[model samples]
Target: MRLRSIVLIAALPLAMLAQGRRNAPPETPSTKTPAELRAEYIREHYTKAEYQIPMRDGVKLFTAVYTPKDHSQKYPILLMRTPYTVGPYGSDNYAGRLGPASEKFMREGFIFANQDVRGKGRSEGTYMDIRPVNPNKRGPKDIDEPSDTYDTIDWLVKNIPDNNERVGMYGISYPGFYAAMGAVDAHPALKATSPQAPVINWFIGDDFHHNGVLFLAHAFNFFSGFGRNHPPDGPNRDRIEMKTPDAYDFHLRTGALANYDEKYFHGQTEFWKELTQNDTYNEFWKSRDLRQYVKNLKPAMMSVGGWFDAEDVFGPLNLYKSAEAQNPGAKNMLVEGPWSHGGWARPDGTALGNINFASNTSKFFQDDIEFPFFLFHLKGKGDGDKLPEAYVFETGRNEWHKFDAWPPKDAKWKTLYFHAGGKLNTAQPAEKAEAFDEYVSDPAKPVPFTPYIANGMSYPYMTDDQRFAASRPDVLVYETEPLESDVRVAGPLKASLFVSTTGTDSDWVVKLIDVFPGDTADPQPNPTNVHMGGYQMLVRGEPFRGKFRKGFDKPEPFVPGKMDQVAFDMPDVFHTFRTGHRIMVQVQSSWYPLGDRNPQKFMKIQDAKAEDFVKATERVYRTNSAPSSIQLSTID
Candidate 1:
């Protein structure tokens, strides 16, 4: 089975942004599709041209430019730089739709440009994964992402025909990283930037790793296709063909992490090799941290991400915060919606799996937030200053909320403590001599992150029902009674776990859930025949490697049967548990193939032998002296 196709269909937002029809009268559906109409429109009104734009370093990068044929008026340029192919290569071959994920932009007549980053596609140069930003460049050869972007914008504004000097950059996922880079040393013409779900740090909390834990399935599937080498003009390599359809079985059967290279990669994938070698947070990973380079941002900035983005949830939040802190008084804004990875770019954001968000959240972002952002900054058409500092979607409430600051300063911090009888409450637990919950974490039979069988990271898994996990013996479940009033959680969650393992090391997985009332009504269609009543919905979940409990840079072993602290902050959430809903917390040691299984020993996990994989009993203390709790930032 080729897992790449499955992952692409699930994770990527391939659908073109549908033309808004808010106030128009309903008409008969036409035979011509939206894509066809877009293509026709582009062919008639736009002229496509390809160029090998030269960088400061003599190397030339491939860029595709689309200028409006009706060049009677000057227009601002909207640019997108991506490692992914800027295909439909020839000048005659125009993209069906263009311009920062909206058809409106294309129709409104902005000069759109898409470029193949250095070393990818037709661009000249070797590609470095998450290329580190160079703070000091004495010569032309000391090139980085920021420098490349600066050069690209400089070339576009100077060489492009009949164009306004102003420029805006935007991209999703990998391209989003490039968009962020464009803002660092922004050109004089570069006025606006929106890095939607950008790739921030790979080793810390991005696509591959989260809190020092490798997201096994995501890393494997992504590397299978993207990690392979590509010639300057040759076709990219295909994804690996696996014998089994079940990724869980395949990964478990593959045994140790070392076996991956020996059996499949065979050291051909340089990035995977680097990942295995740098098992701990070291100089290699730290150098690629984008947060360190967010200082002195010049462009008007807007960082956008989904609250439940399966990938890069940590990126936009941290990127926004970093720019805000590093570049004081800069035009920095953040917009987080109730969608998946790049879901805001898709046509529909009404629902994910069985969870209904109750509105077209994506349309709202594009029309009201994103489009206006670019228009105001790049064209000086709208009042961009009217936009809030933070525009976030309230999940359970299914509504948009604007805040002067993220995690609203007025929001109170509350702790939900675990107690006997599987109870969770804000009140402190009463004194007890021996208060704890214990479970066996077996490497051979690790708990699956999702109940469904999938070959890669499932996009809907972020909000999938958690009842399947809650019923497991390995997962310890604790919940508060139906809330007396609505509980609104608005910011990051901190898990303060007092744990002990029978072995030297372990992994700690914490999940926040919303349990619906038993009498809740099911949806009308119910095609999947899902059970609505008493449904345990997963709001947010994260895995932490026990060794990194003290610090990401430091690794320590847990003394057998000795209590140790394993605390970490999870990504922010904007969720509300209604009055009839119960707030649940589930704690487990292993999340299976979603996160690579911990060897339960202190040695480097990437280099651990088969003998290191052992079963261990894990304990979560809930006494008056050593109580385990989750700190939540809540709004009134």
Candidate 2:
């Protein structure tokens, strides 16, 4: 796991164990020249700047090279390619230097390089959102990410100094994705890579859609902030903003989902179009899969993620597995922490808004692990102290556990069957003819994610709080008996249920949670029960828009009231359901503004005319004929 800059920004003490390379000594007045001032401010930290680097197609990507200024000796080049501009010090500012972020990397006697990918930042080319794939029309598959990385590395190895000829790539979020892409056709000098919170796939496992349902808050927030029309080279823009740019709040106050979409999407939301058009696992998505590429990389790799990471827990886990299966020559490992999306690195690893994580996990990752890993790989020292295959934090017990592989060898795959009347046990269904639970999902009034926020951004992408829905009359809640011993669940979670809906089509949201018993001892001042004790909080949840259940790109109307088997794989999880904690699953029709309201009609979701939006009733059946159950990757 790596330290998140978000946490680093807030929690880092000015004098706390300074994990970075020692700051250069303060110079006397006469020694501080204008160049020194620029260096001190930025350039000195990053000592080299090389702007034009030609890729295979002759497209020159803008690159900023930062080298350790103090050491005249050669060093390994650490590369980071990003769509985000290789800022402040480009061609115009000829004196090559490191930005504050690259200073730490440069100090360790390694060449730090940040480049803009083909279409974004300073690079030349039209920016495509995550570079989506198209049918075989384009030229040379349009010089994909992998090729760009391959060309960049080839340029770095031959041109840079510190002649060891070894290189490593690392980045977080979008850049993290570039790191993964770099490993596909890795250069001989490319020895290692760490993809922190990378975007592996857009639909199946990203901030946008999961199990066919749209992740409304994250998707809309992302698009509105970093939409396609963003200028390729310009001043950094506000990627994260609290308020919506448009006057859609007026429509929201009107309390209508239809009106909001019409005004915001200009009646044409590409997001809506993408979601509805790709209802099944069609070629549109198949061409976009990076697993084939991820599986083939040879670089020694690490996948870092956070349990509470609202952004990308799914991508890391899937990348780890895919790489493990495909890249036999590489050493693969995963590090997960108790923090939120990209939480491992952030300071104040706490509950959203008011919650707190007892301790600062981010500091530990940066100082003790992340920094060291890069230092050792780039320098070829400290390799003897490399960690085990997996280092994970078990939340229930609140301790770190190391294993040779994920899911720990001793873990036994266990199954807890869903029984009648909100009962979950290992026993088979007792009733041969069990009835189904039904709920009405109104497109007008969908379920709110939490009790607090009205229409603000919700954390539904990560934690699955089902308490509000459990009490809802329309939802079906099934829970397992309190654990006799601490039960640890690791790896992907799948739910196979026999479901039916009354309308032409609808959606189902299934959530898996570790329910903490109510803590009656409330703490005052910090009242509002802020993290004081156990409350039925969510662990993980995923939604499946029913029409796309059969496939993501193809939409097929549901057979109303007919029992159809449905399944969705939850993001991988590592949790210890403590002795007294209960595991619960809730099935419902809508999760609202979290997922765009699914019109009960079967038509293409994007082309879903404003009038096509309708509410409908859905049912989940559990009987001998259709024994609905959730299959978890059991770790005994």
Candidate 3:
């Protein structure tokens, strides 16, 4: 990639999205893929520079800046602070793919900056996981993401030549977490930021755990490489070789959680040990949760996430709500789409698995929402009115909705009660008063999150068909006959269950699904055996360790055969169950590998042995007195 050639490509806009977000789009696709265009544009128009920027704590963090060659005008600095390395460390070398953010910013012309936060990558300093914010900072000695960001911004405005003082911050996942923190006590130059898929709460709902159930596969696999506490020289890890392709076989054969830790991971992974030790939602975990300290937020902030994101979906929703509630009248916006983790930042978001969204959702969001947002705040190129308080995509229906507030003012709360004979309806449970559905959940045969065999957590499983599980005897399925008309759901969901276990402890896995018509046509450009017809698409599902039913901080053993009220919040929902589509709900005890087996015992899970694992008779009651139901907010 030559500089002259790169400059030519950058000067000439790419066939797709070269024109900013507002104008007409090409009817057909471009000859060059977006990735190709982005690469060429970066090589030609942008010159890379590596710097070791000093933070307030006097630690020099590694930073990379991509400056547009067109020096006719100064541009706003778009910064991303991440624990992920700032690679292509030299002036001659450039990143393989500059990520989705590059596509928009390259043509639009801005000073794109990517930095290695505190300790990871080529950066100097000790790295901490979800570094605790020093709420009562007295001096430059108290360091955190916000302080580091402030110091970085201060340096950039002072040191970087030919640049506007105005700055914008953005990142996905861990970087998103940094972006959110940067907005707090932001520098005068820091104007706005977007935290896409930020990790807000690990205990409540995030990557590490969800509702107190350890996402074993994700925790083990991710931490094996990412969770290490490297010496200043740095710690590098090779990707773990899989003993088997199927996680079920691997985890099951390992016998118990502690056995696997002792044999493979050992004490090498620091976070795993911390995770195992801090089993409850104690202050150690609470200190890292970002929601507690997101007050007096500076700058215009927009939190973005995917409705189907398996990891960190709870982040943007809760982060936005907290910021909004605490600092009302602030331009705290929210955008959720039909995406996986960071899916909106990709090229194609028209479909995932067998489902079709009927539009290039990724592009639509980048152009219509994200691009406009940065342009308005950073460059004053567009009116801020283009951005809304809440811009949510209506899945199933495949449309966009703008609201002054989420759960639109007219949204009505409706509870679909679980009834006998596997029926679900707005009508209260009218099954036999003494009726209950029972399934024997065995640790030996834990229910697979997906029927497919894979070593790691599958993001697609969030929307994967549940027909396999629904058919299993260990699982119970209930559904509405068929929707009378299109029912658009727009807000959070609540699962209220009356359950009992023969064992002292158990796990409850609930799934909300959409059953397609049996005659539904298969999606285009598809794979064989998709079975779109009669497919059961999972909309939202979560697992709760039965002990957490009391609270996350404390664990209570379930008395045998004693049915109790168990209710928890499902992340949130934004889907339409179209006319002729059946709304189904499934319940079971295990989602193996994805969620650790509960062992059905009262003992400490972190130290549980093979002998502790047992089979349990689980019962879901829909009796008149103890009706189990899921409450949803709908737009009529």
Candidate 4:
């Protein structure tokens, strides 16, 4: 692929500004004063200091605060609590305060605090798992990070002299989870916060279970990294060394994920042990979930997440909804951009895999939007404004839109039925018992998330390799009738299906896809003639596994012969399937290497031996009693 010039024209209408949150100020006229430039430079050149503060539990957590030296008055604080160590500063002396990565907020003279969570960095306290404010087990009410955060905020207010009595929080990935925790029962001093790419739902949404099936790569990688640093102890980064295998050959290596217990569990990883041991939905995971604890959310929040964020997308979206439902009075905003997991924090926002957004969308949001959000909330002297409750970057349209509530109020619940022979149609099949789609799901050979295999760290969500999946005989692809109008889906989605299998337990994956008609493969379209950055198509997709359909806890197995109606919730999407495009739904038994393979036997997931890797024939039943359908939030 040849490189285009760095200058890609900004496509959005300049006049369309200032519509959301009382129309933003006209793109701050390029400042051109010697004094003004000097002020901006100084604001971006603040010094950073490292310190360790003790929590109420007597745990000392490390923190790095970047304060403006020209501090004539008290300034509000912007804090980021993270497990990943916060790097101090750049090597170049004159290069200044924080790097360009933080140029937005730094240029606004706001105090930025980045601290390592307990059990990480120079912080003290035994690092347990992502312990929420409420523990699942019936034990002593042990203090968690939320308590630690309250203690830290209390200490900062009285001790840090040149500080206003206000603070805001935000972070990406794991740090995002901490930010969410910080808001559970936020400190009195905390006024505003944003949990970007936050871990809102653990088992069902975040790192592990997706729709019920365990996210194999994410799970294996995370455990390999964090599991190496087991509980009742501090974070041990040195113990977890990633094992490198050939990219394409990786699937073959991971025969039965349950076998991992025999290889690695030296009696230290009880969670990992429990994870593999309990493949069925049980009480073990329900307790660790954060969805139930998302009540009484304080701090006016701006929940940010990536539409393509492979790791924590479900968490942030679900978090925003839960917050809205639980605390309707609290101000909450959601900003979703076209980027990979925490990719916005990086410099370039190019194609994650085969799809490209045609611009550095991440940089645009960080510099133009996210920074201003903090400045407006934390500092009184911002652009004198506020952003809307939901500011989403629509992918297919290549534009931005805002609304008071998610799913936009006018969206309707539309169903796209699965037709015969891998066909997706709007009309339900007239014949009641013509046939069913059957596929044998072998635990030994499961479908990979991508065509090419790689480490878990590689961009998983950024890909267009449906060709490999389409080739698999086991996969079922159901598409919908071409839409007569533009259908906009913007909220939580659910897939209800009637299924049966020959084995006691089996996994079924339901995927919602946006199929775009392309020009015949032979002729290459002119580059200059490219309409909307050559993206003349829309292809959005999400999948959910079967067993955990009802919920993470209390998973009942297939009775070997009876039909089971399963409802799996698909992740939310803000898509506009245009007039010519079609909505699609693909049902299959496996999304593997990415997701751990289920044994079809209800035993422990991680401890299944080689003999437990049985090949089971799965059946999809579509009758009057067993109606399988895909439901979407469409434009009313």
Q: What Cα-based lDDT does every candidate model obtain? A: 0.89, 0.68, 0.85, 0.67
Least accurate 10 contiguous residues by lDDT in model 1? 14-23
TM-scores of all predicted structures: 0.95, 0.84, 0.93, 0.84
Q: Candidate 3 lDDT (Cα, whole model)?
A: 0.85
Q: Clashing pairs in model 3? A: 6-44, 7-44
Ranking by lDDT: 1, 3, 2, 4
Best by lDDT: 1
What is the per-residue lDDT of model 2 for residues 13-36, given as tens digits with 9 covering 90 to 100? 766535432664443434544345
Q: Could you tell me which 10 consecutive residues in candidate 3 have the lowest summed lDDT? A: 230-239
Candidate 1 vs candidate 4: the TM-score winner is 1
User: What TM-score does prediction 1 earn?
Assistant: 0.95
Q: Go through the candidates in order and give the C-alpha RMSD of each one to the true structure.
A: 6.6, 6.3, 4.5, 7.9
Best by TM-score: 1
Model 3 sits at a Cα RMSD from the real structure of 4.5
Stronger candidate by lDDT (1 vs 3): 1
